[model samples]
Target: MNGMTDAIALALAAVLMAGAPLVLATLGETLTEKAGIINLSLDGSILLAAMAAFAVSATFDSPWLGVAAGMAVGAAMAGALGVIGIYLGQSQLAVGFILTLLARDLAYFLGHGFSRQPGPDLGVWTIPGLGEVALIGPVFGPIFGSRSPVVHLSLAAIFLCWWWMYRTEGGIRLRAVGESPRAAFGRGIRVRLVRLCYCLAGGALVGMAGAAYSLAVKPGWGRPQGCEGAGWIVLAIVIFGGWHPVRAALGAFFFAALQVSGIYLQDIFPSIPAPVFQVAPFPMMILTLLAANLGRAGRVQDMIRRHPFLKRLSQGWSIDPPAALGQDFDPRKGL
Candidate 1:
C-alpha cells in the first residue's frame, strides 16, 4: 500500500513538471484565440524557440538570456502573423502554415550545430516551510512544494489568466472584440490594436514554453526534439478547454498524465511496440474532445434543460468559441 502511494505521488510530481510547457503554450493560444486570431505556427514556433533558447543559453551560459531570446523569436513570428493576417487581410491559415514550415526548417538548419549540447540548467527551488508541515506536507510537499520556477510560473499563469479574462475591464473589451469586431469598434475599442497586442503577448508565452522544454523539462537540444507535435497538441487543448484558461490548463495536465502513463504501460506490457504507446495519446485526446462536445447535441441539451441540476452542470461543460475567431477586422471599413 505504501509503495503504491509513493508511486502515485511521484507520478503526480512528474505530471506537474512535464505539463508546465503544455500549460503555458495552451494558455497562450487560448489568449490569441480569444482575441479572434489563430496563431497556427505553434509547432514550428516552439521548435524554433527551443533551438534558440538552447543555443543562446549554451553560448552565454545564462538561462535567463536564453528565455529572453526564445520570447523574442516567438513574438517575431506572431507579429508577422498579426501584420500579414490581421492587418493586411491575408488568410490567417495560409500565412500561419507557411510560417510554421519556414520556422521548422530554420530550427533544423540553425540548430543542427547545437544538437545534444549542454546548456545552463534552471535548477529547482523548494519553498521554505511547505514541506515541513505535519500531516499533509509529506504527500503534497513533493507534489507542489519543490519545483522549478517554470512550473510555478505555469501554475500562477492559470489563475492570472482566469482573473484577467473574468474579473477585469480589459478582459471584457478583449472578449468583445472577439465576439464582434464591429460591435467592439462601435463601443470605442481599438479592435485591431487590441488583437495585435494580445497576439504578441500570447506568442511570448508560447516562446517561454519552448524555453521551458530545453532548459527544464527535456534538458537538451536535438532533432526529433521530443516536442515535435506539442504545439498542435496545445492548439487542440485550447479548443478542448473551450478557450478558458483554467480548463485549458487542466487539459494540459491531463495530456501530461497520458504521457506518463505511456511510460509505465511500456514496463507493464513489454510486448507492445514503444511507438504505439507514444502515438496513443493523440488519438485518445481526440476521442476525449469528441466526448466533451457531445454535450452540445440536441438531445443532450433537452435532457439537461429538463433537469435543473443537470442544466447547471451542462453550463460548465459546454463549449463556446468566440464568434469572430479567424476573421479579419478592418477599422477603415468600419468593421
Candidate 2:
C-alpha cells in the first residue's frame, strides 16, 4: 500500500511538471480567444520559439535571455496575425495557417546549425518546511514542495487569469470587446487596440511555454524538439475548456495525467508497441471531448434536468466561444 501511494505521488508530481507548458499555452490561447482573436499559428510558433530559445541560451549561456528571445518571436508572429487578419481584413484562419507553415519551415531551416547543441537550463527550487509536515509529508512533499519556477508560474497564471477575467474592470472590457466589438466601440472601448494587445500578451505567454520546454521540461532542442504537436493540443484544450482560464488549466492537467498514464501503461504491458501507448492519449482526449459535448443531446439534457446535482456539475462543461471569435472588427462601421 505504501509503495502504491509513493508511486501515485511521484506520478502526480510528474504530471505537474509536464503539464506546465500546456497550462501556459492553454491560458495564453484562452486570453487571446476571449479578446476575439484566433492564433492558429501556435504549432509552428512553439517550434520556432523553442529553436530560438535554445539557440540563444547556447550562445549567451543565459537561459533568461533565451526566454526573452522566444517571447519576442511569439509576439512577433501573433502581431503579424493581428495586423494582417484583424486590421487588414484578411481571413484569420488563412493567415494563421500560412504563418504556421512559414514558422515551422523557418525553425527547421534556421535551427539546423544549433541542432543537438548544449544550452543553459533553469534550476529547480524547493519550498522549505512543507516537505517536513507530519502524516502528509510523503504525499504532499513532491507535489508542492519541489518544482521548477516555470511550473509555479503556470500554476499562478491559472488563478491570475481567472481572477482578471471574472473580477476586474479590465477583464470586463476585454470580454466586452470579444463579445461585441461594435457594442464595445459604442462604449468607448478601443476594440482593435484591445484585441491586438491581448494577442501580443497571449503570444508572449505561448513563447514562454516554448522556453519552458527548452530550458526546463524537455531540456534540449533538435530536429523534432519533442514538442511539435503540443501547440495543436493547446488549441484543442482552449476549445475543450470553453475559453475559460481555470477550466483550460484543468484541461491541461487532465491531458498531462493521460500522458503520465501512458508511461505507466508502457511499463505494465511491455508486449505492446511503445508508439501505441504514446499516441493513445490524443485519441482518448478527443473521446473525452465528445463525451462532454454529449450533454447537449436531448436524452442527456433530460437526464441532467432530472438530477439537480448533475445539472450543476454539467454547467461548467457546456459553454460556447466568444461571439466575435475569429471575426474582424472595423471601427469605421458603427454599431
Candidate 3:
C-alpha cells in the first residue's frame, strides 16, 4: 500500500510538472484571444523564448533573469503581431503564421551555440510541514514546496486570471473589447489599447512558459527541443477548455495525463513503438476538443435543453469565442 501510494503521488507530481508549461501557454493564449487577437506565433514564440531563456540564463547564471528575458522576447514578438494586425489592419492569421516560421528558424540559428548547454536550474522548494505528510504530503509538497516553483506560479495565475476576467470591472471592459468592440467603443472603452495591452501581457506569460521549460521542467536547451509542438497543443487546450482559464488549466492536466500515460504504457509494453504513444495525445486532444464542442451542435443542445441537469452540463461544454475575435477594430471608424 505504501508503494502504491508513493507511485501515485509521484505520478501526480510528474503530471503537474509536465502540465505547468501547458497551463501557462493556454492561459496566455486565452488572454490574447479574450482581447480579440490570436497569436498564432505561439509555437515560434515559445521556441524562441526558450532559446533566449537558456542563453540568457547561461550567461547571467540566473534562472530568473532567463525567465524575464524570455518573457520580453515573447512580449516583443506578440507586440509586433498586435501592432501589424491592430494598427495596419493586416490579417492577424497570416502575419502570425509568417512570424511562427521566422521565429522557429531564428531560434534554431541563434540558439545553435546554446543547444545542449547547461544553464541555471530552478530549485525545488518543498514545504517542511506539508511535505512531511504521509500520502497527501508528497502530493502537495512539491506543489507548495521547492521542487519547482513554476507549478505554484501556474496555479496562482489560473485563479488570478479567472478573477480578473470574471469579477472585476476592468475585466468586464476587456471582455467587451473582445466580444463587441463597437459596443466597447460606444461605452468609451479604448478597444485597440486594451487589446494590445492584454495581447502583450498574454505573450509575456507564454514566454515565461518557454523559460519554465528550459530552466525548470526539462532544465537545459536542446538543438531542437522536444517541446516543438506544445504551442499547438495549447491552442487545442484553449478550445477544449472553452477559453476559460480554469478549464484550460484542467485541459493542461488532461493532456499531461495522456502524456504521462503514454510514457507509462511504453514501459509496460516494451514491444510497442515509443513514437506511437508519444503521438497519441494529439489525436486524443482533437477528440477532446470535439467533445467539448458537442454542446454547440443544434441537435445536442436541443437534447441538453430537454433535461435541466443535462442542460447545465451542456452549458459547461459550450464554447463561445469572443464575438469580435480576430476582427479588426479601427478607432477612426469608431469600431
Candidate 4:
C-alpha cells in the first residue's frame, strides 16, 4: 500500500512535469492567436531554443543563464517570423509551416550529440514549514517542494498573460491588433509594430517553453528529444481553450494528465505491452475528436449528411474550437 501511494505520487509529479511545457508554449501561442496570427513555427522555435539553451547551460554550468540565452534565440526566430508574416506580406500559415521543417533540421543538426545530455537542474522552492506538516507536503507533493521551477513559472505565465491581455494598456493594444488590424491602424496604432512586438514576445515564451523542457524536464538535450511534443500540442490546446490563457492551461493539464495516466496504466498492468499505452493516446485523441465534434458531418459523407441535431450543434453553437486559428491578419481584409 505504501508503494502504491509512492507510485501515485510519482504519477502526479509526472503530470506536473509534462503539463508545464505545454502550458508555457500554449500560453505564448495563445497570445499570438489572440493577435490574429498563427504560429505553426512553434515546433521549430522550441527545437532551436532547446538546443541553444542546452548548449549555453552546458558551457556556462548555470541552467538559468542557459534559459535566458535560449529565449533570445527563440525571440530572434520569432522576429524572423514577424519579418515574413507581418512585414513581407507572406502567408503566416505557409511561413510558419516551412519554419517548422527548418527548425527540425536545425535542431537535429545541432542537437544530435546533445540529445539526452545532462545539465544542471533548475531549483525548486516550497512554502516554509510545509514539510513539517505531513499532510501538506504529500498533498502539494513536489508542486512547491521538490519539483522543477518551470511549474511555478507556468502558473505565473497564466496570470501574466491574463494581465497582458486585459489589464495593461499595451496588453489592450495587442488585442486590438488581433481584433482588427485595420481598425487599430485607423486609430493610430502601429499595426506592424504591434504585431512584431507580439510575435517576438510570444516567441520568447515559446523559447522559455523549450528551456523548461531542457533544464527542468529533461535536464539535458538529445535527438528524438521532445520540443515537438508540447509545441505541437499547443495548437490543439489553444483551440481547446477557445483562445483564453486560463482555458489553455486547463487543456494543457488535461492533455498532460492523460499522458501521465498512460504510464500509470502500464505500471498497474505490467503484463500489458508498454507500447500499447504509448500509441493508445493518439487513438484516444482521435476518439475525442469524434466525441467533441459529435454532430459534425463525417468527412466522406458530408454531402449525404442528414442528422438535424448534429448539424445544428455543429453549425456554430456547441464546443466548436477556435475559428480564427492559423488565419493571418490583413489590413486589407476586415475581421
Error in Å for residue 317 of model 3: 3.0
Candidate 1: worst-modelled 10 consecutive residues by lDDT: 311-320
lDDT of each: 0.91, 0.90, 0.89, 0.77
Clash counts for all predictions:
0, 0, 8, 6
- Write model 2 residue lDDT over 1-335, tens digit each, in one string: 98898888889989998899999989988999999999999999988998899899999999989999998989999999999988899998999999999999999999999888777887787889887899888789878887888888999999999999999999999999999999999999999999999999899889989889888998888877888899989988898898889988999999999999999999999999999988998998888878877888999999999999999988857668899998889988868
Ranking by lDDT: 1, 2, 3, 4
Clashing residue pairs in candidate 3 are: 124-146, 124-147, 125-145, 125-146, 125-147, 126-145, 126-146, 127-145
State the lDDT of candidate 3 residue by residue for 76-165, as single tens digits: 999999999999999999999999899999999999998877678877766679978898776666445665988888988999999999
What's the true lDDT of residue 4 in model 2?
90
Q: What is candidate 1's lDDT per residue for 1-335, written digit by digit as tens?
A: 86887898899989999899999999999999999999999999999999999999999999989999998898889999999998899999999989989999999999999998777867787888887899988888878887987889999999999999999999998899999999999989999999999999999999999999988998889988988999999988998899999999999999999999999999999999999999999999999998888888999889989999998986886578999999988888754
Error of 2 at 223 (Å): 1.5
Per lDDT, the best of the predicted structures is 1
Weakest lDDT window of 10 consecutive positions for candidate 3: 138-147
Among these predictions, the greatest TM-score belongs to 1
Root-mean-square deviation (CA) per prediction:
1.2, 1.3, 1.5, 4.6
After superposition, candidate 4 runs with Cα above 4 Å error: 1-9, 113-116, 132-138, 293-335
TM-score of each: 0.97, 0.96, 0.96, 0.84
Inter-residue clash pairs, candidate 1: none
Give the TM-score comparing model 1 with the true structure, all chains together. Answer: 0.97
- Clash pairs (backbone) in predicted model 4: 114-221, 115-221, 115-222, 115-223, 116-221, 116-222
